[model samples]
Target: MVRYYGIFFQEDGQWSVRFPDAPSVNTCGETVDEAIEMAIDALSAMMVLGRKGREYGDPRGYEEIQAEAKDGELVFPVMPAEKAMEAYRPKKRINVMIPVDLLDRVGEFLKNRKGLDRSKFICNAVESHLQQNVEAH
Candidate 1:
């Protein structure tokens, strides 16, 4: 196992830092990096706090944090906007070819003839055919 430090940032931009297995945690930094730096700076304060009959709680014991950090991955368990955007990106287009007789039949069904293009008509026919046949099975 790798032994180093743990770090986290608060909503108000304060940093909390601690060793992997230490009771005395430190609160440091203004920005995240600064806060993390401060967190280590405040490590001495953690030891002082312990001397004054206080304790820093183990944060990972909380079920929510443990669940989120499962499998070495951060699972936020919340469907926020960033996650949704990553999930909904567009798919690549694909091309397909079919028989001449089927393509000709789609062409024959047009009313205002010139504006009705071959590809659009064939796509509609293929979609209809797939829907009907797929549901039958």
Candidate 2:
């Protein structure tokens, strides 16, 4: 786990955080503590982007970072609780073509269902089918 120093700035009663090592990484919150929490999420996303771009950089030293801080800007350590990609699991949107009759049936099934949707139904059906196939094999 890499430790990056975050520079916290308060403006208009909101606390915002910025990482020097990653200029694109930033977050804001109503309070300092909240901002720190958001910093973890922001940093994790930055790590993922860096990995994808193949342009990741090492964290700068605290002394060096502190020296660059402004008069009221607070410098502190911000480390992600988990690995970069593990911290954020982005869902992918897929477009699937189903028979007109099947799509109509799905709409009817979900019409009265309070929480269930067509996508969730399809996912559950796929998972159950996969499990059954695995067991059969």
Candidate 3:
């Protein structure tokens, strides 16, 4: 679990949220709840990028933030929602060898579908198979 400190403030009739730990991440919404939800997505995306080798800025100290916050600004603790984190997590690449006949059959099956690549199709199929087997057990 990763936690970061965020500042929530109103700007031009919209609620905006930004994390001190990651200045590059920010989001805006019409309501405070929406803003918080968007902030979680933004934070999770940043975490995903960081895991994929992106550098982030240093986090500000609480005292520094206390001294820096202006009127109407509120400090809020933010954590990435599990769903967001899972959805945004970086994908890993793997090498696999398949029989030529099977590969041709898979390609023929995907020919009618638009934008369904082999890797995604195989990943989804494996995941579904695993889920069904686990549930059966």
Using lDDT, give the best candidate's number: 2
Q: What does candidate 2's lDDT look like per residue over 1-137, in tens digits?
A: 88899999998899999888877788999999999989998888766545545464788999999998999999989997675455465667988889999999999989999868887789779989999999999
Candidate numbers, best lDDT first, in rank order: 2, 3, 1
Which ten-residue region of model 3 has the weakest summed lDDT? 51-60
Clash tally for model 1: 5
Candidate 1 scores a C-alpha RMSD against the true structure in Å of 18.5
lDDT per residue, candidate 1, 29-60, as tens digits?
A: 56666654454444434433342555535334
Q: Estimate each model's TM-score.
A: 0.27, 0.61, 0.60
How far off is residue 49 in model 1, in Å? 7.3
Q: In terms of TM-score, how similar is model 1 to the real structure? A: 0.27
- Candidate 1, residue 23: lDDT: 45
Off by over 4 Å in 2: 51-56, 83-87, 90-137
Runs in model 3 deviating more than 4 A are: 51-54, 57-63, 91-137
